[model samples]
Target chain A: MQAILQLLVSGVLLGGVYALGALGLNLIFGVAKVVNFAHGEFLMLGMFAAYWLMTLTGINPYLGAPIIGAAFFLVGLAFYAGLMRFTIYKPELTQVFATLGLSILLQNAALVAWSADYRTIQIMPAGWESIQVLGAYVPTNRLVAFLYAVAILLAVLVFLRSTFIGRAIEAVSQDLVAARLMGIDPDRVFLMTFGLGIAITGVAGGVLMPSFYAFPSVGSFFVLVAFVVVVLGGLGSIAGTILGGLLLGLVETGIGYVAPDLKEATHFVLLILLLAVRPHGLLGVKGAEKETLK
Target chain B: MIEIRDLHAGYGDTEVLQGIDLDVRAGEVVAIVGANGVGKTTLLRTIAGLIAPSRGSITAEGEAIGGLGAHRVVERGIVMVPEGRRLFPRMTVRRNLEIGAYAARARPRLKQSLEEVYALFPILREREDQLGGTLSGGQQQMCAIGRGLMALPSVLMLDEVSLGLAPIAVKRVYEAVRAIRDRGLTLIIVEQNVGQALKVADRAYVIQGGRVVLSGTGRELTNNEDVRRAYLGLTEHA
Candidate 1:
């Protein structure tokens, strides 16, 4: 029973990172209706940025998050303006291919520049400590990261709900034609939304770098987890992603404790079962079929 | 005032509207009536700048607006309610109305426009927080009209406002249309119900095969013998 409790605690902490990772992907997909296959590459790039900044400038990875996030946001904006906008109005297959090409290009670029070495930034400025809660030991860094993720998520939610541009994003997501009728320039909204989505990954990458190693293909693993969370939570639902992240985190950790080898397999099996039983996802909108992909 | 001279437009290979000419003076309600697939909606959509006219000039107050996009046209004070009530389904009635004033040019007058829209359709005020998709057919129609008014447009175009409504709901929508006309805005309505269209319009045009077949004062076209027989279901044709 104590072992089970310990696993649950670790899972919850890990879920925080997953939720943050999925948030940006969900936001971009929800608003733009395009799957950013290169989203994981963005994460990989962000982690590397933080790692290099720390190595060269001796800056803390935590302190470097906003800088990397801002840089990623600009890159995301340029990407949308230069590429995604043109292909968005095209057929679904075209959009998919365009983004996939971008993903391949970015991944290979990172490989050429950084090589295949797994790199980590060791910046413990001393006095780092862990805490014990209900007989489960929690690492100080994971706790801080979890709290930071939660704070950031809440801030994003508030911004999306209260600000004018945020509401415009929501309006565009619902119906682009109707949004245009309301005098919203769909192109501008798309550009900014894409930027915002990428920006979120910058935050996630910075936060997770202290504990996780960075590699050219690192984003692939987390991006797959993000897709699973998105599907489990329901597409275009911010709240759903948060819940899905926590639930999956707990489930995976619990299963890992029972059979460590089956941890990854368990998630895929659950996903398949969920798809077969509830295709709309846990909190998805009704009649929200595959049409959203279009 | 609005004017379209020698307009040509199409979707891909087939030309939907060929050399169409029309005019709508300020404070006038003009009805463009036609059978299904005759390009009535297409004509309104073109005027609202949803589709680019292949060739021709659309002048609003003497400024050519043919090449402008729909949002740009709205910024110029021409707004469309669309054929169907294209309300954002998940949005609240209030948010849907708020989005109507997304044009920065319309920002200063947003409060007055909101009040005017709520006054014109009190039902919307009552259900302001309800999701637009949950509204009844009549209520949704009202919301659609209200949304257009929220733009504070000088010229409002409604496409098929009377479609898919009960007789009583249709009457309510028309009454609102009449009130809109009383406000002295330039109105262009595309309607299938000839009786209602004729009753509300100051001038009327009947379109056939993407061309204007007949046009006159509302009463003149309503009283035309051929129009009565073909469209009004008079006994001579039956």
Candidate 2:
């Protein structure tokens, strides 16, 4: 019974991490309709940025997040202004390969500069890395990341609801022509969204770095998880992301508990089933998937 | 005060608006009427800066605005309520109206613009919280126009406002257009619906094959045999 409870707690926490990771990707995809293949790379870069910031400046990732967020926001802008701006209006395939190439370039650059040595920062006190709660041991870093996810997600929802620019972003996401007619600059909205999305991704990485390793190819792994999460939750549906992540987390945890060897296989299987059975995702706006690709 | 001199534009290679000359005086209801696929939309789109003209000049209040981007054109107070009543479907009606006041010029007067819009279309006030897509066809058109007015536009260009609407809905929309004219806003209306466009228009232009074949007072064109036979769809022919 304890083991089952532990699995449940672990699943919820794990889902939180995935939710945070997928949020940025979904935001960019929702507004710009650009599926960023380099999303994981952005997260990986954030992890490294946090790691280096810790090692060099002695600033904790949690506390130094704002700085990382601001920097990544600029990187996100450059990503759009320098490269994505050109590919965005092109064929969907062009966007696919462009982001893929970026992923490759970023991974290689990180490998050349930092080497493949896995890096992690032990932020929690000794023996306190795991905290007991409801008869389950929750990793301290995971709990912290989960809290961040909840706060950020709620904040994002509020931002989307209450703010002018946020509504403008949502406006652009729905109809570019309509947005333009409203005097809302779609290009500017895309720029802001990319910046905001990448910034969140960077912060998510920094917050999760203590729980996960920071490596050059780390993004490749998380990118798949993000894609699964985004698809499963319903692309462009912000609230739906939480449900999707939780479902993925629970299934994976359940699988991991019963058959540890098949844990990784669950993601792929769920992705396939979700795509085949319900392409729009559980709560996604109908035909959202078609709107982007077509 | 918008002037188009020999405007030439098109979609990549095949030119659509070939050396078309048109004029829209300030505070006038000008209508551009034509049959289907006659580049009516293309002309409005070009004027809105969705497509840059290959040649010719567009001057509004003495400022050239031929090839400016859509957002830029909007910033200069020329907003187009596009064809198909392209409301942000998922956004609430209030949010849709709010987005219309997104430009720098409109932002300052957002509250006033919104109130004006709600006053113009009382139905929008009731539908404020409803999703834009959920509104009926007529309501959506009004919301689209309300959104355009939210921009505090110096000149409002409406593209096919009556298409796909029921007769009563179309009448309501034109009534709203008349009310907007009473508010002293310059309007450039594109219509395949000839009679209605002419009725609201102070001056009307008859466009054929991408060029203005005829221009006169609304009554003059309304009474013309060519316009009557070609467009009014009154006299049946084999």
Candidate 3:
């Protein structure tokens, strides 16, 4: 029982990071209606940014998360202004290929810049690493990441619910024409959404740096995890991402215990089955996948 | 005042508004009435800066606004309450009303606007906490019009205000529109309901095949034999 409880705790902690990662992707998809194929590359860049921040300045990645967030926000804006602006209104094929092309370019760029070294941050004091919670030992870093994830997610929800710009983003996501009629610029909303989405992903990357490795290609692994979480959660729903992540995490951890070698295959199988059975996801609104921004 | 001279606009490769000229003076309610495919919606859309007019001039108070984006046009005080009440379904009625006051120009008067909107549609105040999607069609149209009024626009354009509503609900909406116009706001009403539109408008235009086929005072056009034959489906005998 304790062994199972330990896996559940670990799964939930891991799910926190998964939720954070998927939230950004969902935001971009929800508002802009662009399935950002290069989302994982942004995570990779963020991890590198966190790694470099620590190596160069010795600032803890958690402390450097805000810095990474701000930088990534600018990177996101530039990405939209330079490339996404053209493909934003185009067909799904155009958007898919455009982002896929960007993924290749960025992956190779990171390979050229950072090489393939896997790095992790050492943040904990010598003897105080794990905490005992309900008879299950949990790592300090994982707990901190979980708290940060939940706090940031809550903050995002508050922002969406309270602010004018946030409501405008929601307005655009719900009905673009109606939003336009209200004098809200969809382009400006798209820019802000992209900036916010990428920024959140960057912060998540920074937060996860202590628990995970920072490598040029590590994003490919995470991107798939994010996709599973997003699909399971419901596309474009913020709260749904959390639910999806937790579910996937528990499932993956359980599978890891039962069939450790086939753990990775579970994601694809679950995703395929979920798509076949309930493509709208567990919490997603009905017919949402069919609703495009244009 | 707004003017459209030889405006040509269309979806890609298919023209919808071709060589259209219109002049709407301040404090005058102008009605554009036409059949379903006769470019009534297209004209209002182009005027509101949703669709860019090709090979023509759209001047608002003598400034060319043909190429300006919708948000900018809104800043200049031209707002549209679309045909279908396109409320943010998941959002609350209050938020939907608040978003209408989102433009910088209207932000300062947000409080006043909200009060005025609520005053015009008192039921909306009662249901401020309710989701916009849950409202009946009549109530949704009221919220939509109320939302447009929240923008504090000088030139308010309403597209098909009576599309899908009961007769009494339509009467209530028209009454609110009449009240709005009495306050000296310039209005452009586009509708397939010729009688209702003409009744509320000061001047009227009959559009066919993307061009203005006739124009006169609301009563003149309403009484015109050709307009009756074409729009009202009334023959010489009737």
Task: For residues A35-144, write the lDDT of model 2, one tens digit per residue.
Answer: 99999999999999999999999998888988999999999999999999998788889999999999999999999999999999988889988988887898889998
Local accuracy by lDDT, each model: 0.86, 0.91, 0.90
Question: TM-score for model 2?
Answer: 0.97
Q: For residues A1-294, could you state the per-residue lDDT of candidate 1 as single tens digits?
A: 788778888999988878888888888888888888888888888889888888889887688788888898998899899999888877778888988898889889999999999999765556665778998988777777788779878988888777778888998888877777788878888999989989888878887888899999998898888888878888788888888888889989988888899999866887788788776568777555375522
- In the order shown, the candidates' DockQ scores are 0.76, 0.77, 0.88
Measured over the true interface residues after superposition, the C-alpha RMSD of each candidate is 1.0, 0.9, 0.6
What's the CA RMSD for each of the models?
1.8, 1.7, 1.4
Model 2 ranges with Cα > 4 A deviation: B236-238
Which CAPRI category fits model 1? medium
Q: Across residues B1-238, which tens digit of lDDT does each residue of candidate 1 receive?
A: 8998988887877888887889999999999987889999989888888789998889999999997998899999999998779898988998888888878877778788889999999999999999999999999999999999888899999999989999999999999999999989899999989889999999998988878889998999888998887788776544
Say which prediction, candidate 1 or candidate 3, comes out ahead on lDDT: 3
Worst 10-residue lDDT window, candidate 1 chain B: B229-238
Considering only N, C-alpha and C atoms within 3 Å, which residue pairs clash in candidate 1? none
Candidate 3 chain B: 10-residue stretch with minimal lDDT = B229-238
List fnat, each candidate: 0.73, 0.78, 0.94
